[model samples]
Structures are given as C-alpha cells and as structure tokens.
Target: MDATPGVISTLFTNAKVFTGETETTFASAFRVTAGVVDWVGDESAATGDITVDLGGRTVLPGLIDSHTHPALIAGTAPAAECFPPAVTSADDLVAVLRAHADGLTDPDAWVLGRGFDDTKFPGRRMPTAADLDRVSTTRPVLVWRCDAHSAVCNTRALEIAGITAHTPDPDGSRFERDADGEPNGVLTEIAAVGAVAAFIPAPTRDAQIDALVGLGEELASRGIVAVCDLLSTRIDDPVATFRTAVDRGLRTRVALYPGWDPVAPLADLAAGDREGQIRIAGVKVVLDGAYSNRTAWVHEAYPESCDHGLRLVDDADVLAAAEWARRNHVQLAIHAMGDRALDRVVELFADAEPWLDGIPSVRIEHATIVSDDYLARLRAARMSFGIATHTVFFFAEYDGYEKALRAEQVPDAYPIARLYAGLDPLALSSDRPATAWSGADDVMLSVEAAVRRRTYNGIDFGPEAAITVPQALLLYTGRARLLSPLEGVGQLAPGFDGSFAVLDRDVFTVPEDEISAVRVAETWIRGERFS
Candidate 1:
C-alpha cells in the first residue's frame, strides 16, 4: 500500500463528522496532514498508513471558549475548592478554608477564596464578619460568592481595608450593612467591592503570565483549543502579558479584548496585525452587572425594590468608546447583562452605524437579559455575539421558576434559542474565577441547559426557549472561533489550523442529561498533540 497520496501520517477514518455547520453521515473518512485536514471523502488512494476506526463515534471540530478568566482558577485556590450551598456547616466551611490555606507558602498573604452560595446556609444566611472571622483570626480572609459581585471579608481583612460603619460607600459599589449602619463585611457589586480591592496587593506581571500559562495547560487537558480571554488589561499595553505567554510557548490560541479605556492601547496592534491565533479582537466595555448578582441594568423593575439596576458605564461613554473603536476598525464586544444595558448597547451600535464602513462587526457579550425585540434588532443590524453559557450555571442552584426568578420575570432573561432562531452569532464560555463557571463543564452541562431549559433541580425553566444539541455545539466551536475571527481556527479543513479533540464518547449521541459525562481523551493543536 503506497502512502495515501498526500496523507501525512494518519487519517482519522470511520468517524461521524459534525462539521460545525451541519451534521453529516456521509463523512466516513477524513485525512489530517501537517496539522490540518488535507481531505475528507469516501475514498482515499493511500492504504499503508495507520487508521483508527471510530466505529461510529461523533467527531467535532475543537471546542472554543469565547470568554474565560483562567487566572482566578490557577491562583489562590485548589481545583477542588468547595463551592457554597453544598458545604453548609460553618465548621465544615472553616475546615475547607484551613485545608486550602495549608497549601499556601505565604502565611500572612491574603487567603482569598471564591464560589460560596448565599442560599445554602441555615436561614439562607450570607456569611457575616463573625463567620469569616472564625475561619482564621491570625490571617485576613476574603471569600467571594460565585457571582463575583459579592464577597464576605473577615474582621482582620475589613480592618486592613479600613471599612467600618463610618466609612462611606464607594461610588459604583455598595457595602451591605447591619441595622446600626455597621459594615457587615459583605461587599456588593463593583462599587463596594472596588473599595476593598483597592487595598489588596496587585499581582505582578510575571504572576499574571504564570496564571495564564497554568490556565492554558489546564484547558488543553480539557480539550479547549482556542479561547477569548475576558481579562482586564492595563491601558498602556493590553496584550503585553498574553504576548509574553505566547512567546514562552503557550499552546492555546488567544483572542484578547481588554477593558475600554480612552487611550486605546491595542488600537495600534489591531491595525498592524493580521495574524489570527494571537490578536486584539476588540474593546470590552461593562454596561451593567450580571444576572445572578441582580445587578443587571433592566428596563423593568427588580423585585427587591421595584428599582432598575444601576448602569456601571454610561451610554455616552459606551458610544464614545464604540465610535473610537469603529473609527479604528476594531470590534466592540460590550458586556451588557441587563435589559436596559442591552438597550443602551444597541443604541450605541446604532450611533456608530454611519461610521461602520471600516469597523469589524460588533458583538454583545452576556446579553443575558436582552428582550426578543432587541435581539431582532441586533440580528437586523448584523451585530454578533449571544454568549451566555456561564449564566446557565447560576440556575443550577435554584429549584423552580418562581423561586429562581420572581413571578413577573418568569422567563429569567437568558434567551438562548431566540438568538439561534434569529441567526445570530452565539458563543459558549465560562467567565472563570469570576464565576464558578468552567469551560470544560459548559460543553456538557450548559448544552443540556440550553437544549432542555431545565435547571439542575429538574424544573423546567423555559423549555420553549431551549436550543438544540447541534446548535449548542456550534456555539462552542464555530461561533467561538470567530473570537479571533481566526481564519481556519475551529473547523477541521484544509488551510485551517490543525486543532482538535478526541472524545471519550460521542457527545451528540449521549442522553442529554449524561452529556456532561463525556470527557476529552486527547487534544491536538497545530497538528501536534498537547494533551
């Protein structure tokens, strides 16, 4: 048997291909050479090379996570760190914290932890100063909720930050207080959280790079080939740390979008760079908070006080930023979680319509609360991005519709199928470290949530709003590749980058509930196996 014509080493034959666009049964054999697919068909001329028959397992393009904050995972906490509501007793919480702290070399270093649930405690008590104080009196401790919008600090930590009853609330944030106006050590939203964050020591650039590399390795193991990193970068050099990691041989393809600043540090890079794997994609602006935290800027009133949530960044600021980004031909992936915030983002896009000649298509990140009308508008405008995988994880804790969301807001805001139906560019992601959200977990868990619209408790949240299994996979792969808008990134085709994952089981064939059980057995990047 002569070498299969142009085949490199092997041909992944006999596997069903979910080509990222449509499911196909005719793709019986495909050849991978030099890291990219050289050919796909029923007949190949070569026969001497190795061929691993897949029997009938499904094969997909590599999964892509469009949003992630991996630094939070690899630093400060163990992978098995306990998330709240599951571990109820205060004593158990202390034990968990102590166990985590035991691994750290820095004794006086702040023992920061995250992913606690407020609903799990007795009386649904939010961890108070006393609760955190009991964990470690000698060291200052701060444990943030899974939402990343709230945190409980110990007395020592509070003292270090000088937060007390007398301390005025910081702008754009709120400190949850007790009856006497005393700070209860719980900081809410960005405002109150920003106050204490100002006092915490900033991680060095080397540390940031380490965290990124560590995160990249972890995701590679989980079969993620590309990611849109939602990291907050410095104004002067947005991609400096990321570029350092790439130069140091980090394997994952990263498309970076830094927080919006007037200076536009990455504008020059975007202008000059045409490379796909490592590029500056856009400007990320936060218009409001997240749904789980109840800080999203909604047009309708929230049940808590019949009040609309606060807008973190004003529309004027968003428009100015959008205009600048458009003028520079950079895309804008604005973070708009609230309905009102989504409205504001849409308006900003509208404001830039005349100048969009040179601009990249705009995308809206976490439009979690967007209405159907607005979604149609986005579709009409040809703006992309319906990224909402991480939000589905928040519903894992709730039991029913009314309990999870108030009566009037029964639909719960995240309209997955609507985006799909409207033919928008929806993507899947895990806003890690900020949320207990994970990319590996999203492939299975979030897909089921999107397909079934069922919460972990088995209650149907919105079955009609659910997306299909095929559509979910596309979001994770094809739509996600658009992050770098990297040419030939996600699909397994000639002229495309050779990046893919071998699965332990076929994801599409599995029972919807058991989808999360499938694991990645192998991952390859640029034609070389990374894991």
Candidate 2:
C-alpha cells in the first residue's frame, strides 16, 4: 500500500546507500515518509518512529529503463520464446519450434515463436519457409527476428496471408525472394510483417491484463520500478489494456508512446487515459530500421551493393508528427538509428518551438551511429534533444554490425563516453526482446557492456568509449529520469520518490568482467517492500 501524509516514518539504517546526488555521496541511513524520501545521512542523525537495519547491503536508486517494449513483450506472451544462448544454432531453433508445434491441441492453430538473430546463426543464414515447414507443414508457423522489424513464416502462413509470387510487396516493406519471383517467407519492416501477423490470433483483454501483471513481477524482480513502453500500439487499445493491467495489480509505472501512423493515427485521449499510473506520454515514429538487420539508413552504402538502406518515414511525415505533438502538448520521439536519419531529424525539428520547458522537446530513439559532426550539429541546434541508445545492441549482435558497419564507422557505434560528456538526459536502455541477447533487460548486462565495451563473441568493440561504474550508474539513474515522464523518480535524495533496489553483491566493487553477475535481492517502491 502507498504511504500516506500522516504515516509514521521508518528509518532504514546500516546500509551503504548511494543517494544519487553525486558519484561519491554515500549515506548510511534514509527515512521514508508519505511514500517519498524525507532524509538521507549518517545513521546517528536519522530519526523515525521505527528503525530497521539493512545489514550493510548496497542500495541504489530504482532503475529506469527509459526505453523498452514491455507492452509488446506482454502482448506477445502466447508465443513461444526463441531467444539466444538456448536457441543459438538453426538446429536448436527448429527443435524448439517443433516441440511447440507438437504440443498444440488444435492441429490447425498457428505455431508462433519470436527472438532469433540470424547474424549469430552458423554462416549467418536466416531461417526460411522451408526451415519452418520442418516444424509443421499443415499448421502455419511464424517466427520474428530479434529486432522485431521482420519475420519469417512457413509456406502455410504465407498462403493464409494470401502472399504469393503474384503478391507485390507492401508500401514500405519487402519480402525476401528466391531465384524466381516468390517470397522466401522472410518479411522485412512492419508493413510486410503485418501482412502475416494480421492472420495470427491476438490475445483477449483478460489475457493481456494477466500477462502484464506477470511481466510487472518479472521487472520488479530485476529491480526496475518504471519503464517507457516505447511501442505501445502493438497492443490493441493500449490505454484500456494498460489501465486494466494496472488495476489488476501491476506495480510498475508505465509511460505509453503509441506509434504514429500517417494513415491511421491513435484515437483522441479520453478522461481515463491520463488518470492512472499508466498514461499516454508521447508519440513514436520509426524513422529508420535497426543495424542488426542491415536496414538502418546510412550515409555510406553497404560494402558490396550501392544500397544505403531504408528511410521508413519521410520529411513530410516527421514534420506532420512534430505538428501533432505540438497540438496535443506531448513529446515527439523519432527512431533514428542511422547517421543519415539523425541528420534528417535535426533538419525537420530544429526550428520548431517547444510546447514546454525543463524537459527535452524531442527525443531520438537509438541514435546508433552518431558521428562527431552530428554531435556538433546537435549542440548547435535550437531544439532540445535527448537520446535513448543501447550497448546491448552491439554486445548481442556484433556479427551483424561487423558486416554492416564500415571499418571507419566502427567506433561511432554507441560512443558511450562521448555521449556522456556531450548530451544531457542521455540514457542506455536494454531494448529487451528487440535485442538479440537473452535476458536483454537485465541491467547488469547493459552495465557490463558499457564498462567493458566487449561483445558476446569476446571481441573488443571500442575500449576507449568505455566509462567507469559511477558514470554508468548515473546514466541508468539520475540522468535517465530527465527523459522519463515520472517526476521525482530515479534518485534517492530528499523529496525524491522512495524507490530503490538492494543488490545481492557490491556492484561498484565487483571486477569489471563480473559486473553482469550481480543480482537484485530486494526492490522497494514508494516506501513499500515490493519484491
């Protein structure tokens, strides 16, 4: 239960508390009153109705994954998970899907799975319709790539969607082809993926709520109290879905950003939309694809071909999105993963006036390839911008990046140290299932990647770009909150939210290579023992 104004304060003492005020400010005790922080200092100076000893554990401010796709992850709960380590090879993937298909009571029901990184497959081969046909020829099978921008369906699945040799590719997406004109079952971008996904059955409202409640517990266990559902539109009627989920005991606070579709925009907000822990915060536009898939719009062409990748949203589309955000008094988040896309974003929004102050006017999601020139232009621009990038992307999908990035562009990928020095409100997020790695949302994994600058294959990505433990923690905590809609969060200072996590081991003292081994023992939210 949430603490009230008149509630007696409880002092938690004898712990190493990092107040998030600065890298070196350690307090021995803290008092919580009315579900918010009241004081933090030496244990002898603390006063409260009751005192509890933490036995010298390490406590950090509640973690904020400023960019994640929890709503989409929950919405797709019915599908079998096919993420990496467990499903590393193509044989492993086929076996997992085959088992899922065998357990189906309904013979004709679609056999669905997600999270496969073709880049990690031996020889970098993607799964095809023929590979999925081994699972079940009669039943439709569809499995998504780790990036979530694409999928590969079995022949039956393609047939159900009426996609064949005669079917032209959708407006902004493509179907990988064979020697002839037939689709090889690989669908690129949402338009092509949606062609088959529209046939897959969506979960009912009750199921949606149940899944969200479960996901909330999982997040709490990982010491996350808040997240931004960057792509909430994947769920039908996101507002009602999240509202019901929260009402059904979901503890994590969510900020929803419905995708902006030029043809079919989100419905106008109702009274209930803005009244609860879950609320619509902004609009998201997919300006480009991800690096792992070799579709991120770039200035340089892909090594062999003259293909410079794709531009999902045009200048006019972005301008219109900016206008809509201004009219609705919300933030505009552009998914610009490539250098070219980043340049275009600045050009589109640089002259626009902000709707509010104290926070960024616009946000760039996955500025994956920001160069020195781009950073200089950003600093000179009139508009205010925040960036939500990922180290997990390079850590998990290094093989893909090894192929996609030119030798000269390698260091420019997620320059954490440079970003830390140059940008305010710059955050490092997991991007979860969209990332190729298993347990992608685990804060420790991203932390280790940032500190080590090492990849899954044990390759040194960019050692010079690495940062210290304190600087990385600030990115996940205090600095991250600037991009969050939740105020007074991501800190342990006076007047801040009384939410924090106790770790099983001392993360700051752990060896650089062992950082990912640290675990959360307790997660407290609003002065309550949550997990």
Segments in model 1 whose C-alpha atoms lie over 4 Å from true places: 1-9, 24-26, 43-56, 71-80, 84-92, 203-206, 234-238, 247-249, 261-276, 354-360, 382-391, 397-404, 436-442, 482-484
Instruction: Give the whole-model CA lDDT for all candidates, comma-separated.
Output: 0.65, 0.85
Per model, how many backbone clashes are there? 7, 0
TM-score of each: 0.88, 0.97
Report the C-alpha displacement of residue 493, candidate 1, in angstroms. 2.5
Candidate 2: minimum summed lDDT over ten consecutive residues — where?
1-10
Stretches of model 2 off by over 4 angstroms after superposition: 1-6, 271-275
Model 2, range 1-531, lDDT digits (tens) per residue? 222356798888899998766678788889889788888888887678778788899999988888999878877777778988778877888899999888889877889988999988899999899899988889999998999999999999999999989889886689888999889999998889999999988877788889899988888898898888899998888888887888888878888888999888666666656445788778899988888888888888877769887888777888887777777766789998878888889988777676757677799998988778888777777888889988888899998899998888888889999988998868889887788988898998999999999998899998889988878888788888887576767889889888899999999999999999999999999889889
Best by TM-score: 2
lDDT of 1 by residue, 1-531 (tens): 234465565566667766675534236566666566666656354342557666666667777877765534433433334464445555656677777767778777776777766665566567777887777787877877766667878888888888888898765567888899988889887667756756655566677677667777878877777777564453125366666877777788777666775444344444445354566666677777766656677777766567676677666667776765666666677777777787776665643453333223676776665557776676666454335444355445452123335554555456677666664456766666555433424466677777777765577766767877787877787656554465566676656666777778887778878876778777778767788
